[model samples]
Target: MDKRLLDILCCPVTKSPVRLLAENELLALNRAIAADQVLNGAGARVTGAFSGGLITRDARTIYRVEDDIPVMLADEAVATSQLTDFPRS
Candidate 1:
């Protein structure tokens, strides 16, 4: 995604700032978001912010990538296998 485009994109539901991910850390599962580990519920993750492609720390949503176009529509988004609580080990 382009830096100019990322600046304009926002969460379709929250209309809040959206950032990109590097290292494929922000996984897109079935067009939704997922992550192996996220630290918190409220904080945001940008990776490189402008350089990386769009992703979020919530791990429940993804800015859909379509034909080199980002469909940042909230309605088009879905959730991955939810892991609300992590085991204390």
Candidate 2:
């Protein structure tokens, strides 16, 4: 993701600043998705793993990046709290 774009993007729901998800964080998220344990805020099961993602600065939510495009919809946001064994690093 471009630095300028990241600087301007914010979580659609909380209006909070957004940042790229760290490698470990992405790994943890993917792990959960692989287990079919992750869901969007709209209660829809997340069927695919994210190749890239933007996480809210507060770390409460994540928006997936597909084909290098960020999916910023609130209903598509995945709650970070839902992932078990989330990596701290």
lDDT of 1 by residue, 1-89 (tens): 67888787777676667666544433323222234332223343222221224454555554546556776655444332342442111
Error of 2 at 74 (Å): 0.6
lDDT for 15 in candidate 1 is 69
Query: Which pairs in model 2 have colliding backbones?
Result: none
Write candidate 2's Cα lDDT for 4-32 as tens digits: 98889998877999989999999999999
Instruction: Give the local distance difference test score of model 2.
Output: 0.90
lDDT, residue 88, candidate 2: 50
- All candidates' TM-scores? 0.49, 0.94
Count of clashes, each model: 1, 0
Error of 1 at 49 (Å): 23
Q: Where's the lowest-lDDT run of ten residues in candidate 1?
A: 44-53
lDDT of 1: 0.46
Off by over 4 Å in 2: none
